[model samples]
Target: MASWLARHGIQPTVVERASALRLGGNGVDVRGDAVTVVERMGLLPRVRELATDVRGMQFVDATGRAVARIHTQDPASPEIMRGDLVALLRAATDVDVLLGDSIRALEQDDDGVHVTFEHSPARRFDPVVGADGMHSNVRRIAFGPEERFITFKDHYFAFADTDAALGEDRWVTMFNTPGKMAGIYRSGNHAQAKAYFMFRSAPLDYDHRDVAEHKRLVSEAFAGEAGWRTRQLLDSALTDPGFYFDALGQVRMNSWSDGRVVLLGDAAWCASPASGAGAELALVGAYRLAGELAAANGDHRVVFPRYDAAHRPLVNDKQQIGPNVRLKVPKTDGGRCVRDVVARLPLMKAMSAVERRAQARNARPLPDFTRAA
Candidate 1:
């Protein structure tokens, strides 16, 4: 967002609450039109070089037995670690960034937005955007509390750095019990492995920033659940400071902008990580938002509406998980067994072919920003 805005004659100041750009994150996927956004920025080669070379996914039994497999040959969508992608984006943009600081308050008028920072001096700008993640502070201050928009999917998920010995190289090995799923993602490019855990339950009550409490919650949720190296993964991740845990949810808002303040990425429309479209939505949303703002001479009233119209269709489509949810978290032993059987059947291939065709038909070509540029 900073880069695109700057390229189009807008001075952007990026405020990050983190002391620095965090380099620790799980693999993030660049699918569909997000590839165009990267290529247009001349970072496609860099992204591909750092891409996690995951062969595909494999469903396994508790006894380390592979029951079914999916080998993807699709190059249009590649997975790269979230931190590496963020690094690439940071390198692409030349903007003034204030670290360890965030917006304390925002007062937007017809002319501009008056802002106060947590650790920086007060200032005003023509627009202020809350591109923060799902539980965005900006969203809370500007739009209201998070519970109004965050619809929990009745599941909590966690991913953290773990021992690579837990999984075989090049394949994401997953195991499922009723109401829960656990997996290890083995990226050949990176020596360290990532542990993924998800369990279906009522909404959890815990502070979002409390890592220790989050670990305890995860361990408790998976307690007594045996097999598939669950004990070891939990043990390792509980001590690892990089543990990530949160409820699986999506942010649905009728509007992306309020006066001169607006939202972007997961803050505005989080389809959840399960959709594998978070990065795509953020990339395309940022590109379109900046383009609209630039085209309108920074007049957000016109820019926000145009941006919404151009982007919502893609988001609405990507938000649909459909059968993917069943494939991820089977609610019963019978469901898991049936999925295994379906994977071995010819119907799996037919579904894959149909999905590929739909993808081709719904290809969202990036608007020719050359004219807008």
Candidate 2:
């Protein structure tokens, strides 16, 4: 967002809660319009160079034998490690960033917003954008509580660094038992592997900011599992300091703006990791937001609504992740069997091809926001 705004002669001050840039996460896909976003940023070549190169998913049995496999490679969509993408974006952006500081209060009037921060001196900006993740601090201050927007999707998941040798090369090997799934993502281009775990569950009580609590939740969820390298993966993941665990949830909002304050990316509409569209939604939404602001000559009233109207369709589309979740962690043994059978069939690949073509035909051309101003 800072990079896009800077391109349009707008200087943006980035406030980050963490002391340093966060460069740890699982693989994120950059496809469709997001590919254009990166291309415009002059990072497409580098992104491709750092791509995960994962071929497909391999479903395994109890003894760690591959039972079925699905080819998911697509030239149109390239998967890159989240940390690599973040590093590329950071290098591309030239802006002042206030690290280890957070907004304490936001008092908005007709002219601008009055801001107070936790560590830095208070400063006012004409418009404040919340690009924070699902539990956005700006949204809580400017709008209402998180309960009004966040919808839990009946599951929780965790992922962390693991041994590369645990799984087959160039494939995400998954082992499932009814509602639970234990998997290893072995990126063809990277030496480090990632362990993924997910299970069906009702909303559990835990602090989002507490890493110890997160580890415990994940451990408890996979405690009894001993099949197909589950114990090995779990033990490795639990020890990693960069382990990430979160509820499979989505952020839905009627509007993304409130006066001079507006939201973008996961703050406005997080379709969750299950959608495999976080990077896509964020890149496109930020470009549109900054472009609209530039076109309106920094007029929040004009830019906010335009930005919301332009990006909502893509968010709506990505938030439909029901099928994705079911595919990963089936509800029953029969369902898993059916999924494995379907995955092994050529029809699944053909259907995916058909779906991609249909999406391409239906998708509106991404606007050339560079010329909008």
Candidate 3:
């Protein structure tokens, strides 16, 4: 967003709560319109160079034998580690970024918005955009309480760094027991592997920022499982200082803007990680929002609704995750067995191919924002 706006003669100030760019996360897919977005930014070559090159997902038995494997390689959709993509985006964007500080208050008038920061002095800007993630501080301050927007998806998940040697090369090895799954994501191109865990549960009460509590919940969920590297992965993940934990949830909003304050990325409409569309949505949505603003000469009223209209359909489509979560963490042993049997059949591959073809046929061409600029 900052990059696009700067190209159109609009200077954007980015305020971040983190001390620096967060460069650690699970792999994210860059496909469809997001590919066009990266190409426009002149970062496509570098992005392709850093692709994860993972082949597929493999379901493993408790005895560490592969029960079923699903090939997921797609030439059009390159999967890259989240940290690599973040680094590339940071290097591509040229703007003033105020790290370690965040918005404290916002007051809008006809002229502009008066802003107060956590550690910086009060200043005013023409408009404020919230690109913060699902638990957006900007959303809470401007839109209201989070419960009004966030819908819990009956699950919790965690991921952290783990020993690469523990997992197979270029495969996501998963072991499921009832409503829980423990897995290792070993990217063929990266030295570090990530331990992934997900379990079905009612929403738990806890502070989102409390790392210790997150670790405790994850530990308790997988403590009984002592097979197929689960115990080892759990220990390694819990020991990692940068462990990530959160509820699998989505954000739904009637509108993406409230006066001069607007939301984007996960702050506006998050389809959750299960959808495998976070990076794609963020890239395409940011490009569209920035393009709309440029076309309207930074007029929030003119651009906000247009941006919302242009981007909502894609967001709505991605939010329908269908069988993604269930496919990963089956609710019962019988379901797991059925999933394995179905996965082993050629029908799964055929269905996936059909879905991809239909998507390609229906996909609208991405707009050329440079022409507008």
Local distance difference test values of all predictions, in order: 0.87, 0.91, 0.92
lDDT of 2 by residue, 324-368 (tens): 888899999999999989888998878767766766665656778
Model 2: lowest-lDDT 10 consecutive positions: 355-364
> What is candidate 3's lDDT per residue for 1-373, written digit by digit as tens?
9988988888999998989888999999999899989989898898899999999999999999999999987878889999999899888778999999999999999999999999999999998999999999999999998999999999999999999988999999999999999999999999999999999998899999999999999999988899899999999999998999999999999999999999999999999999999999999999998998898888999999988988887888889888899999999999999999988999888987786677666555677889976
Which of 1 and 2 is ahead in lDDT? 2
Alpha-carbon deviation at 89 in model 2, angstroms: 0.6
Better of 1 and 3 by TM-score: 3
CA RMSD for every model?
1.5, 1.2, 1.1
Q: Is candidate 1 or candidate 2 better by TM-score?
A: 2
> Which stretches in model 3 have alpha-carbon errors above 4 Å?
357-364
Give the Cα RMSD of candidate 3.
1.1
TM-score of each: 0.96, 0.97, 0.98
TM-score of 2: 0.97
**Pairs that collide, model 2:** none
